[model samples]
Target: MATEGLRALLHSVRYEVLPAKASEEKVLAHVPRDVVVTVTASPVKGLEPTLDLTTRLAGHGYRVVPHVPARLLRDDAHLKEVAGRLREAGVDDVFVPAGDADPPAGDFHGALPVLRRLGELGSPFARVGVTGYPESHPIIDDDITVQAMWDKREHATYIVSNLCFDPRVLGEWLVRIRRRQVELPVHVGVAGPVQRAKLLAMATKIGVGESTRFLTRHPSWFLRFAAPGGYAPERLLTRARDALTAPSSGVAGLHLFTFNQIAETERWRRALLDRLGG
Candidate 1:
């Protein structure tokens, strides 16, 4: 069931990378410039590393999107500086998550405020993405999460679903969001081919430790990633093919959580494309 739309999605996929050591090098070595590279901000290291990596990647001609977590910014001034730097570096897109920073570093406590501030700053980014959850967030209520999107609809350009293993849940989420009148296009999030050990070790550093732990707590997700070999991202994509490729699905493309396995992820994407006759 590899339709034309699926093939196109594969061909124009975006890779989400953590701003960890050697990540930049790996992306430069294995990832083609055509694929968009999104750098994640860490609660431990703050936004400096994420911005640094994003700027360098943009310098190398990669379409880069830096995660500007709300809690990481000190205030409106900090947000403006960050925006100016990215705009100067030619970055036209950004992903704003509420972030995991405890006690919040500054005035902005959630994504809505940061997004609103971005508009006050004249909406420097051409495309701004907000997070969507197909599964229940560890700390937030499901209804509140959906309402967050409704509240930020005017300030955001698109929605990027968090990593979800169940195709059923993801499909249902697409329907629910549409029902709520969230018209933003979605970039489905999928995990790349990654070893369980590597993922677990860096989970907290990348701010997905809770989600990673959820995988081990659930047998299905555990087996999917902790099997004899590694996990195949294509299986998840294929299972959710219908939801992803439907005409009114509003699916933009993919946002792959590579976890810095740059070479392996790119290889998997290319092989899948070839198999699909792309």
Candidate 2:
């Protein structure tokens, strides 16, 4: 039988996708309507592609979430416009992150400002997510990241941890957050069934500074993903079970980074659910 935490996580999981050309088709074909789908925003694409995908997905009856990266918005007006657009599209959820835009598009430079703005707008969305770092962010200090969470707690509905491989670090992070009193429910970010080669290639193509930051943040990535045959999502899940299942951890669910490998990720999730008797 599935343990309570595992079952709860599987049931409330979210699949994160990019706003790529084929992403819509892949998600429509593979992901069930019940699963929450989150679209990522990037500096190159601005926020249009992410918004377009989210609107279309929401129309298709998926509980869609679009990333509202702080640096992407030109100003408060842009933030309001984005919020209105999402509301009109029937979207009730959003994920806010400090984007990678080198020269920020405008006044907002980090997630806290955007989150605070959202609240000032009378909290348009039903669910708002903010990023948490189990592993240290390449550009920000670990203490600062924790402080950011503390600052954003009142505005956000939950926390979604950035991708982390070390279960030890993840467990320690839970302790740290609780001790610090950052009490938002957390959705642990985990990689889906993506190939190592694809991840490596994507890492390189994201730009020199970004690639360097990626490597700095994930130095052990190769070693962990290089597991003889292929990396299994279960290994991390199994190891992190105790930390996740603990009542005080406040882990709400899993945010599966599909990396646009929608079908493969969906298959893996289903198979794992079956095996766990979920």
Candidate 3:
């Protein structure tokens, strides 16, 4: 039987994007109309690509959330300008991250500072999201990362975890959050079904710092599962689904890292939902 909790959780799935050409149409076609779509700001493509994509998606009536990488914002003035653009496009939510840019482009070096500036700007966003790591980060210690979450909790409306392959770890992390009294809703990050080689190539091409951090933190898992075979996110999701639907879990939804494999990811999601009779 499909539980109400499962249905509610499934309805909250969101798709992630790389700011590539034709990505807007591709993602919109693959994702359900009501699902929130987030466009990532690539270091190579910079923020403009994501901004442009978000504007286009919003115009088409999709709930679009663009990532505002702190390093890319030149300063407070630039931040205001960006907020204005988003408001004009009808965007009322955003995901703030520290970005992969090597050096600080402005006063904000991390998400907390940029989030503070956004608060000061009095933007009209209904919700603001910050990244969370269930696994350890490459450079930041666990204590520092956890403290960062506590600092951001006051400003952030939700937490979107970085990608993780282990559902037990994610479930335990959710428990930990509740124990710590951090009640923010969480969006569990899961990569969709993608070919191993293709995923690896795309990761390298995109130059994502998070991928490096993930590999560093979970070398054994990466070595074992990320081989030249088809990879399925279902294994992880299935293991986590029960915990995800637990009343006390506080995990709100899924954040799918499509890796631009929109078609395959959509297929996987639909199949899973169908298996769940929803």
Best by lDDT: 2
Query: For every model shown, what is its TM-score relative to the native structure?
Result: 0.92, 0.94, 0.91
Query: In model 2, what is the error at residue 83, expressed in angstroms?
Result: 0.7
Candidate 2, superposed: residue stretches over 4 Å from native: 201-219, 227-229
Worst 10 residues of 1 by lDDT: 210-219
Q: Is candidate 1 or candidate 3 better by lDDT?
A: 1
What would you estimate as the lDDT of candidate 2? Answer: 0.89
lDDT of 3 by residue, 1-278 (tens): 22556656666889898877768779767777788899999765678888899999998889999999998888888898899999999999999988777677778889999888778777468899999888877778876777788899988999999988778988888888777777889998887776666767666766567567445555654554565564567667667777888867788888988888888878877777787778
C-alpha lDDT (0 to 100) for residue 267 of candidate 2: 93
lDDT of 1 by residue, 158-187 (tens): 999998988899999999999999999999
- Candidate 2: worst-modelled 10 consecutive residues by lDDT: 204-213
How would you order the candidates by TM-score, starting with the best?
A: 2, 1, 3
Q: How high is the lDDT of residue 55 in model 1? A: 91
lDDT of each: 0.87, 0.89, 0.81
Residue pairs of candidate 2 with colliding backbone atoms: none
- Preferred candidate (TM-score higher): 1 or 2: 2
